[model samples]
Target: MRMKKVSFLLIALVVAAVGFFIGCSPAKEPEKMETVRVAEVTRSIFYAPQYVAIEKGFFEEEGITVDLKTTWGGDKTMTNLLSNSADIALVGSETSIYVEAQGAKDRVINFAQLTQTDGTFLVARKKPEFFAWEQLKGSTFLGQRKGGMPQMAGEFTLKKHGIDPHKDLNLIQNIDFANLPSAFASGSGDYVQLFEPQASLFEKEGMGHIVASFGKESGKLPYTTFMTKESYIKNNNETLERFTKAIYKGQLFVDTHSAEEIAKIIAPYFDDTPEELIATVVDRYKSQNSFATNPLLDKEEWENLQAVMKSAGELPQTVDYSILVNTDLATKAMK
Candidate 1:
């Protein structure tokens, strides 16, 4: 019995010594995060994939730290990209196309396409049981500045229905997007076109209701894309690749999940909005297929967007497609 007790003590001492060495040994180092500053063109449910990525910690998973800054409008957002204040500009691909057409020294090259569907909704001041685009013929519609995507889209849709956006409807220009909903609610404009949550928010408050969905009308336009200077793209290949992979994962997460699930994930990132309204807004976007499944901004969509821009007189000249888009990075990201 003594011999057995001595053997047991010896085993215990060996185990204790092993454990002590393990405890004193160095731990595995945490990942050092890479930073990527993104200048978001506009804050809306349209860019839900990006918001989902940020909220779900996908950036951290990829060892990337994303600093998302909202620049309110695409013009300002593109400027941020031009000045090197932002590594990527999240705006319509047309903005970059225009820059290239204008002969910018460092042209914006689109790498990733975030959304494929137009996110604007034309909300009539009064809700109508039967909706039609022709109903807007004589109405004074609130619109943005000429080159803005929402205004251009609104013009495109109206013209498609045989109504002259410039002559058939009185379009009020240069209205701040923030004031559009309230301005119409206060009987300032007969109709107002705006991005999600605002349209639903207006509907929720009984101020205005949707008359037309631009996404459904526009049918797969290149709505939102991520671009950077050609020099930046050539230099920071690894950082951009990792960032794309993380956000592309977020895009897939959104595509597979229900609107309600994504709404909960992205609610905190948007303006202080209630979950139900967020869900409603998300459902509206989901129904229209607003997001792209991958980061690829294909040639067909790019051409379609340029056509729309040219139709609206926003582009001075057509740029060579290869010069404006570099999909190789996006391809690497997915792999």
Candidate 2:
């Protein structure tokens, strides 16, 4: 009876010890997720890689939860960034230059470029059997807002083709960016510049015909990029590195995947637009190599962007590429 009692006591003690140890052990904590607020100039198929990153779990994988907002125009997007309403701004590199020219206390920096070429397309009311640059002369041209990247690039291309936008065409610049398509549809101009899938949608609706691409004519530029204030980079270096990594992954996915696959993945973002139309726009951008395959913004592209701005008389003085751009995060991300 004593032996039986002793064995039971031993077993009970062992069980109790085990239970105590199990209960005293520390519990694992959940991973911390950082929220990054992004203000995009506008939402379009032009920013496909960014959409790919968000939809493919790349940003989530890097512990980032994106809070994206469309600010409609560069001015509004920069306003959001400067006011701390957005931590990041996806806009033209020229905005940064303009800010720097104005002597901002905390200068904006272009860390990762998203587009290598312009995104606008020239849509004509009537499809020309043989389209030429000279055809724009004496016609009412509905251009983008003055001093914006699209308008600057359009002017640059027009000069290249020997048709001065101001002298040869009746240029209209007062229309709001969002209303350009509607104005064109309501019989506003002989030609209009637009970003996809609006251009594609217009063609589908028989509202206009795509005659030429500003993206192709303007050559390679650091047209669209992801930028943030310099102070943000200094404070959130690690977060910025992770953000660039996700951007790089997004770029790779777009490069490797077909337009159909990309369109399918990013379809949710454009819920109102048809999948077929998305694919068509994606294919068009892909074919023209509009999307940057990587995040690094090189010096040559920077110089070209400046040239376009200078030609448009929008640039007061050229800002050095090194002062406004930092590729360190992009380099670390790629590795």
Candidate 3:
């Protein structure tokens, strides 16, 4: 009887010791996530891939939490990046060239291309039965900011059609970027150049008619891209690679999915805009091949962009494409 009692006591002591050790042991911690602050020039259906990446959890899958903010304009977006308020910037590639021209200490580098073509449409108060470029002559044209990518591409297309933007039309560009749509709705110009959702919404509300796509007319160029400071790339190479992987995944999703499917995924980003309008804008952009299929910024497209800038007399100096662009991360992300 004593032996049985001793054995039971020994067993109970062993069980208690195991339980104490198990209880005292540290618990497994949750995985740490890195947050990347992104400053985008504007929020529109034009940047559908970015939205798709965020909405579909591509960034999260890569252990990244995106903090997206619209800085309203390219200048503002770059300002946020330069001041360290943003880890990455989604703006026109021209902004990086502009910063390089100014000789920034931490030069902005174009890492990934998002939009390969201009994302603007020429909207007129009245739609002609058969629209012609010649009809823009002698009319009041509301262009974008003087040296912006939209205005540069618009002028490039205008010159291609043999219409001198400065001489053939009464051009107005003094309005702020945010006020352009309202200014047009308030009866400001005979015609205006607008981005998506706004362009489609204008048509839906009978405020304006889309006469032509500057994107289709201007040909392919690296219009909008993702950029970051040189130091950021050097210090956070791994993180940037993960970010690029997420971006490439987003680009692939946009490439494979239908406009309606994309619209459904990205609707949360543009909460106010109707899903139908978003889909319409997405279809319009997709039909023109405005959205880039990949994140690689092509050398040919970069040169074409500089050509447009030069045509607009906005090229400070021809900054070497090698100096301003880094495709290493994008290439690695593809694999």
Candidate 4:
């Protein structure tokens, strides 16, 4: 598409401008690096704080070498934590609810939360004069799998606007995340919920136009968080504290820096996307306060996430937030 081509051109220009300057800059090295395996659900701009920490040597400065894995979905990322393949997982806070539902003996606990609101934005194939939640009635929408926050957020946004998610729209759930763009291009659905880079990428291709940011209707909901098993957090307090400290620094760096600057720093992770588009995506997130300033979990927002899931029957029993999240490490990191 013409728009996608333009996006690629813009990235080329930005890369040419900053690539040389950054490549020549010295990368800070740590005297000793302690590798920590962290499983991330997705490599998205919404998770920019972690990416910023990785790119800007914040982790290295904390004497941590990060082994970041992209599991592509929250369930798998949580499994990484459950199986001990990963030391920690950066996942949707809603994941904690699902894990609690399973009643594992060594339950995973969240010590830090990064995204306080849903990062998903709605994209429609054709732009219309009036883009409203009610407009989705009678339309087919490409939604994420059940239990994932993206889909749950979409459902919440619909209900808040007086549209019943079950009765108002024909929702599709079988599409793989990586195939969403192609699926959209083929007209499988009229609307799709996506995080940054994917949403920005589709917009660049002129395949779809952003209709609504679900965050507006969903309000402040706990989106993504960092979690480890109770035993791991208990045994590796120092390491976990250092990780939070570095991520906290990353949050501050993103807040103080321009979107373009932050984009450049994390550009390597988004190499597939045009730098210009990635910067645009970062600007959107910056405006939304998508990342948290500190890792400490917000009680009210976490409750909202649980409420959303319980509304959908994804959670049967009430979950106590205190048991699932701890603030001491993040508190110490802040101090």
Candidate 5:
């Protein structure tokens, strides 16, 4: 009887051990995801892939969550990044150069460039008379007003061609972008400097012709970039790398996807633009096949711009090229 009882106890102990082992054995837990906050200076069809990445969960798939913010222009965008309100700003090289000149090294730095080619154009009246740049010498240019991008861009273009903008051209200021299409349709101003989609609008209105393409003159003006604060890049290096990789992926997507698809992705931001118009613009971009993050700033171009800015009395002193752009993090991400 004693032997039988011992045997029964041993069986029970073995059964308990098996149950404990089965219950406590490690089971795989779901992977923890990382989140990244980001921002953009403006909303345009140009930045469609970023919206697509967020909408399609590409960032999430890469273990990140991106919170994107948009501002009015470069100045406001810089403010957001400096104040820690944003982690990135898609801004012009001109703006980056100005910021770095001020020695805000802790808060400001450029990562990778977004577009190599300048997408700027001067739209003029539709007539044989307005076909050439020389004819545009004395024309009234509808600009963003004094100290605005259009005015400066116009001066750059004019001066590059050895035409005196101040004496030879009339640049009107404070023109609203939303009203530019109708303004041009009414022939309010003889010419206007426009970026994509809006440039397409001028073409569609049958009122304007592109007298000059900025890309034709400037090899690479550094139109837009991925900017970040030094502190963020330092503390969250891994996060930055993942974010940059996601952005490159976004660039690839932008290159492949159709305009209609892009328009659909960015529909939330551009409430006023018709889908048809967006489709037209995207198709145009496809034809151009212009997409890049190459931060190569030509030395001669920089010197030429500096000379122009100096002649226009825009720069107080010569800005160092090295301080103006940041390509390290972006290069790493691409690799």
Candidate 6:
């Protein structure tokens, strides 16, 4: 009977050990908290892949619940990021560089580059004399905002052709994108750097002719970036990777998809724009090769963008690009 008791206790101990092992098995990684916040500036057709990622549940598949916020411009989005209101932002390299120089925040790191191709075009009323940059002297140039992409493009284009933006011609700021074509129609702006769809619209309406394309002239400068605060980077590394992975997927989608498919995805944002115009805009992005890259911009390209901004006086001083770029997570995400 004592022998039987010993064997029973040993079996009981073994059962308890097995139970404990089953109970304490690492908790299955806790389902990976599905929540994130991101922001993008402007409502344009080029952002179709981002919309596709969200619409197609790419973020959801990666266990992320995205809260996307849209703002007026990259400057405003930078403000939101510095204030810690948003986690990630789709912004231009020039705008972010200016923000870093201003010392708004210690570390607003830009990881991935988007939009290798600059899609800026100068539109003006068709005249025999207006075909070249030299003829633009003494004309009223309407610009979107001070230090924005349009301004930088205009400055670079003017400087390249030996025309003084400040002396030879007058540049008016605060010209809204929607109103630019109409203003051109009324002869309010002699020449304006308008983006796609708006640029296409002016051409279609016969109000303006494209004087020059800066993308063609400037080679290729890194136009936009996916950025975040330094604090976010340190604490939420996994979230950043997931976001980057989704973005890479979005870029590939943009590369392979049709114009009609792109228009369908971005149609919700541009309600007022006609279907034909939307198609044109999507085709333009495809034809011009304007989308964010996988693992984004490299160090040299980033510096080149800063140089362009510096020449345009967008940045007050030469600031280090390291403070505004973090590619660690993006590199990991690519794999």
lDDT of each: 0.85, 0.96, 0.93, 0.85, 0.68, 0.76
Best lDDT among the predictions, by candidate number: 2
Candidate 3: which pairs clash? none
- What is candidate 2's local distance difference test score? 0.96
lDDT by residue (171-234, candidate 5, tens digit) is 6666766566667677687888777777877677776777676655554445566777777768
Ranking by lDDT: 2, 3, 4, 1, 6, 5
Q: Which residue runs does candidate 6 get wrong by more than 4 Å? A: 1-33, 127-130, 174-178
lDDT per residue as tens, model 4, 61-176 = 88999999898788788888888899999888878767777888888898988888889889999989987677889999888778778788778778888988788889888888
Show where candidate 4 strays beyond 4 Å: 1-31
Which lDDT tens digits does candidate 6 get at residues 1-335? 99999999999999999999999887666566577778888766767777778777778778898888887787688888888788888877776666666676556778876677667788877646537678889888887677777677668778989998889988787667667767777888788888877788888878787777776666566677778877788888888888888877877887888888777777777889987789887887677667664756677777767667777887677666566677787788788
Off by over 4 Å in 2: 1-27
lDDT per residue for candidate 1 within 69-161, as digits (tens), equals: 999888899888888899999998788877877779887888988999788888888878898778888889898667877777777777788
How close to the true structure is residue 56 of candidate 1, measured as C-alpha lDDT?
90
TM-score of 2: 0.93
Candidate No. with top TM-score: 2
Ranking according to TM-score, highest score first: 2, 3, 1, 4, 6, 5
- For candidate 3, what is the TM-score? 0.92
What tens digits encode model 3's per-residue C-alpha lDDT throughout 117-203?
A: 999999999978989999999999999999999999999999999999899999998998789999999998899999888888899
Pick by lDDT: 4 or 5, better one: 4
Candidate 5 global CA lDDT score: 0.68
lDDT, residue 172, candidate 2: 98
lDDT of 2 by residue, 65-89 (tens): 9999999999999999999999999
Worst 10 residues of 2 by lDDT: 23-32
